[model samples]
Target: MKATELRHLLEAALPEAAHAEQSDLQLGHMYLPAGHIKAVALSRPVVVGDRGSGKSFWLKSLVDDTRRQLIGKTFQQEELLSCEVKTGFSPDVDGDYPTPKDLARLVQDGLSPDAIWYAVMVHLIVPESLPGNLVFWKDRISWIQEQSETVTAKLRAKNAELHAKKQCILIAFDGLDRLSPSWRDTVALVRGLLQTQLEFGRYSQLRTKAFIRPDMLASPEVRQFPDASKLLSLAVKLEWEAIDLYGLLWQYLANSSIPSQSAAFRKFADKVAKLSWDEGSNGVFVLTQAVRHDENRQEQLFHQIAGENLGRGKKSGNTWTWLPKHLSDAHGYTSPRSFLVALRFAAVDSNKRKFAGKEFALHTSSLKSGVSEASKVRRHELEENFPWIGDVLKPLKGLGLPARKQDVVIKWKKAETLSSLLAHHEPVPLPEAIKETDPASILAALEQLGLCRLLSDGRIDFPDIVRVDAGMTRKGGIPVR
Candidate 1:
């Protein structure tokens, strides 16, 4: 088949297989899908992630499964409905924007139109909107008390109606905390809605889950929520095991291979069926066995084959011996979701090259390329949407930091500094001799920025998906090139 056709086939096949439940454990993409189930069962759960981290995919799978159980087949649903609710912010702009009073009215309208809008304004906004007693707030508190009863009645009536319906109304609010000029006000508005409804038992059934990225949670605005931590438990992050990722890939491939339609697919499956990672304990490894066999037989055969390569019982020079030795340096696969993406790209390359029946081998270049692409996209998105990391890097590299006489003298030189690289969240750490400025402070700031994390007693490193440029290596570590 042509590369284009193979690419489509691999892309289609991989996700189905890797994303399957039974396959998830074996391929290392395991995750607690129970959290999602609990969220739906108990309260509205806000799910969040940086783009390309499979946020939509996870939710889609959950919803599809749920719908399948209900309707006896996966629902033909559009993802746009979820997308709109999640991402509802606009960048900052200068304007006499809507006030808390106006926003409160909007909520009142959404909740219960029976509440006299004027009464709501008097109860909620009057306290802060009086002619400056210079400090007019004190003067309007009395006015607020006067209208409270009328507004309260309306709100209660609305709550009663919602309760009578026996509906578990989940208002999933996603991406509102993303990059926006009005993000602060938007969050405050959401909090206000939660607080208001929380008081009434009738309104309690209508829960709202706001999905927000981790960095966004660091905002002082969010921190102001005394219950931030508690509320955050209702939030979900997409963390999957390596096995889960592999399962998803395998299932995806199995479905896409169209075994019933293609001789090539059957051949491919046969070759992969008996494929083994190493030799068996009896020491009989075969490099050319077909892989299209049944599951149990395939696993048994692979183990036997692997044990053979690794050597019988106590034999040395086994394939397993060399396998771990090679994998040790490449074990930074923190999440199955990321690893799955890299695997998909590799499968595309292999399938396109007509290597379906060939032995499984890691394509380092393709893996690195896929990871690099994904990381860059994620980083850009995180930075753009999450201002809560506000000036987190600024403490290290921005204009406010103190500059030395030598710094100014050599500032125009071609050399890069620890601070500069850190600002970009680059792979390698700054070398000691080169870090002349407040090195400790810069390092701490980088950690705060989540650009680098402490790995051991004192060693620091970037997250797994990010990598050092080819020629660069960790300080004092051997270079790969």
Candidate 2:
């Protein structure tokens, strides 16, 4: 096919239906049906997960559903209010670097309190009675800026008017790590006054729900709150179950109509679901679900699917292993953003094949030049087989490395070592890459500076994201010591 024609086909080939509308476009288009959104919103659960998991997508799903109500749609008032938080925090800030309360206040001063309150109230209180109260509040909006203690009480009291009309309110604080350096302080401030604020909103009728990362959950600052766990209505850890993942991938296949769904959808759909769930063997692929077997099915399945098996010509018998219960039990997927990242990476691998009968073909030779008859691959074994190699290949992506049509491939092709590649490591200037002193002295200096390391194999490696995604184009590359 012509280049333009091929590009168009690839774009058209994406699975749009698998994702919900109004979701982050990167998430393969997941749409939570209105009912699911309503249920999850009302649940007011504490969602936890890793760095790349899909927690953001889940929170966004709720936000999108709640936002829909303001546009004249008929959604349950209680349900609409279940996912809203009244906290003065802005969702726009990075979770790792959130704007401080005093700072947020200053930035928000230009916007009317009633406007912000309206969003908070609508998502955490009854909407039917809001119109008249909203108008009244708007008229008296200037009173919100007053410094008097009574003013804060008065605002809380007015919020109470809406609280009287509802049973509960849900306010979700997502993206904790995305905040400013004061992330721990921010969590402490929110938790310290949470009940008072809830009580303030109690007259306003609402509660707070925080979606957190595993690391954040263990913070003494947040743990110091005596009723922290109680205040959090439900604690859900989101890990990918084989079935959940299968459902996702199946939906993607159906939506993409790659070679038309009739070609491979039905046969693989049930099989994939069955294999993923493995009802016969108890596993905790989805963290929320109960185990089927007393054995630790979790690690077995995770190891099997995560590519923990084969790497660089060494095939361990344990390669086709399961996810250990300890891994899930430990991480809890409190922050789902990390999990989503892994899935998206997996999706990239799954879609590369043109199907033949029951098997799917993978393009590995495309990973390097002048190599033909690249290995045929399977989805079930990818994640388990080559965990580190998977990390390297995921960013390079497409037959492009081996062929063309690559994503981010051009940026990585020049490095002598994957670890030293510019895409994987920021290009240090000549002055920086080299030091006037001896190379050994430079290595010693870098070690002291915490800038670089020598791996056991005698190759240099940096201890960050940049080095993780880099690779060397040369064969039998040097190892760091």
Candidate 3:
């Protein structure tokens, strides 16, 4: 292919590489992560994952008919289609779940959390079945509190009817971290929902799924209930293995609308014996099979995009492992969102540089530059999710990582980082779980957020994903190359 054609192909083939936070249900293709295959198929009640690990994506997919059908087939389970899925809570404005303020008010009213959830079910499943002329959610809540037994009886009857038809009602909840004003209240609500799920287990036809962030699960308040271990035991942790990431990349590439671009990608796949087609689709191909590890094929696939080495030649570390390793957090977790963002930016860089003679779409310099772009995005995401972390870290921009705790404390004192953070965000009650008023508490919070690691040697280390974007250098004051 000519330089211009390849550039166009690079642009067209990798458009919008990152998955949207709110995934579109209409997108027919999904790369089911191997670790999550069984979890999704079994309908686990509590699913936990860090941000960008596809909790929302899976929840949205389960509610989408076409995507649900495809996913069901992937697991070879027809029962997936028998599910009547409803979103109890989501970040999407149009989602059915009540707002955080409404939930907070309900909790404050001393209404039983279990009863509140039952009321939500009544609203979704069969509003007419509810007693006492309770049409709205607020009214329904009052009625449930006033007549708990009656509401339970009605839900039981409806569950029985669905059981007879061999169907199940699956209610999903996400965005729990935003569902309440304080950590205590959020935990109380989540505990109630989990207890309700346990109680409903007897119904056989009703199931509840909650997508919770890892931090929320780790909160002591959320796990204070008597039988919290049962829910915790059943929780499915959403994870992405390296191979899973590659599978996703090919899945997107195979679905490309540009004929020549798709053709070129397929040709590249064939070279590594990694290309296969779906049964019915004429031109659609499966790049890498969804499995635990296709090391050879995955390595080849990465090389196709990022080339054989980090730069120059094989002497420069292997590109296959370098991309994800550099993008990973302190916990060694690299989200699909981050990976895709890097890929997209790399392609854009490759095209802009016009490296036509290179064997791969991404040059080493372009790939490294892509990592830098991804780092910025990841930092912004952390800030949005936990605004306090940004406030704490912004003052330490020029400080080097893998430094002693005392060094950080010195910087903290010099910059008045903690004092300013408390001052600017004062009077807005901090989440009871996160203590940001002092230096020790701020460092602890940063460690929990995976923005930095507390080394056993009494030093601190920031992951490349965070350090590069935060403008922090490594030990010895060496800047990121």
Candidate 4:
């Protein structure tokens, strides 16, 4: 087949949902990594990840019956198929839980954070028992407090009944960062939720899972409590390995969708992974276990299309490894969404080449172009969460990479980068790292964000993706000239 045809197919195969929104409910795009089984199974109370790591995606999937059952097939977890999932919190505003305003007001009303979260858990687990007449959150929390014994008894009874029926319930929490713009409120709210999850852990049939970010996990204020160490010890990070990233790529291709023609890409994908497809109920297609965990098989299969020599200028490379090597963050983690975005952009960029009868589906130049394009996406994502990042780094544009750390700091100082971010989330609380605005602190923050690399020689290195996106120059990680 021609590269053009395959490129077109690839462009259609990858999903564009880079930002994991709760509304993304496509069953076909569900590619659960083996490591995430515990997180999705609700066995782990906390799921930690950075942006684009599928935290919110899995958060929404827990409440989705179709998606949950599909997750059930991947692992032998019983609660997955015969379980009740409730949204304890999410980005979308709904009456199921307290809104940010409600949380703020509840705190101002002198209600303890633990009490507020416990009331929310009670509402999720036993909604019928919560007063139907209570319209406002404060009133409902007051009622729950007044009837604490009754509520506890009801929850215990519900758990016993679920045990009798061999079913269970999971109260899922996501978007905690959105609960309050104030960092203080966020810490209190998260600490309360953690306390609530620990209390619920006593019930085998009732479980609670909170999907959070890495920074929150590292925050001492949030995790301060009795036995906080023991409860949070079981937290899992939704990290993507190179093999897992490629596995997800193939999964998207194998289960690629076009309205009314669901299985159209199956044969094309068969030529790639050569794995059996399990046609589950409602025709949701997923690959057999052989495809997800087998790193050797994935690489061998990928090379069948990516060709033998992806490098040039008297050097050799494997596209299977090269793609991720060029795209990963400074910490060596690549987002599934970023990987797909790079491939999709590379496919589209390769269409300009018209490499008639070219053996490879992607060209080296196009692959580089794809990385550059995906970095733009990454830049936007970084800006979206940390708006200060763009302003801080703007002065370094056109500056060469592997530069001295002091040089970069001088530019940031000259630009007054710290002052610009001081007012970003002002009336509302700023996100993490805003308090530490010194040049040295800012450099550390950038390293934590995976935007810059710290060198042992006291130099700073920018990943090719970030460097290219920032219009900075780098000399390595490409074919040797």
Task: Please tell me which predicted candidate would have the highest TM-score against the true structure.
Answer: 4
Q: What's the CA RMSD for each of the models? A: 13.0, 13.0, 3.3, 3.2
Per-residue accuracy of model 1 over 353-381 as CA lDDT, tens digit each: 32223233333243344444444333444
Model 1: residues >4 Å from true position, as ranges? Answer: 1-8, 12-32, 44-54, 57-165, 182-202, 226-230, 233-236, 254-337, 351-358, 361-365, 386-442, 445-450, 468-481
lDDT of 2 by residue, 1-481 (tens): 1222222322343422223222344222342223233334444446665433455555554455433343113234444643343332436422212244532452245533223333343323433423345433323333333433544454466456655655444455666543333433445444543443333333434555556765456555555654666645456655665334333433333344344431233333333332222211211111222432212443333332333332334442232221111112111211122223223333354455443322212222111110100111111122232132333343432212112222233333332223432233211111133234323333333343333445565554432221212332222311111
* TM-score of each model, paired residue for residue: 0.51, 0.44, 0.88, 0.90
In order, the Cα lDDT scores of the candidates are 0.37, 0.35, 0.72, 0.76
Alpha carbon lDDT of residue 239, candidate 2?
62
2 or 4: which has the higher TM-score?
A: 4
lDDT of 4 by residue, 38-114 (tens): 78756688889887888778867777787777778667776688988888888852438888888998888889999
Lowest lDDT sum, 10 consecutive residues, model 1, at: 84-93
Rank list by lDDT: 4, 3, 1, 2
Decreasing TM-score order of the candidates: 4, 3, 1, 2
In angstroms, the error of model 4 at 94 is 5.2
Instruction: Tell me, by lDDT, which candidate is best.
Output: 4
Candidate 1 lDDT score at position 395? 29
Look at candidate 1 and tell me the lDDT of residue 77.
28
Give the least accurate 10-residue stretch of model 4, judged by summed lDDT. Answer: 16-25
TM-score of 1: 0.51
Model 3: CA > 4 A from native:
1-10, 13-19, 22-29, 93-96, 108-110, 180-185, 272-274, 279-284, 288-292, 354-359, 422-438, 475-481
What is candidate 1's local distance difference test score?
0.37
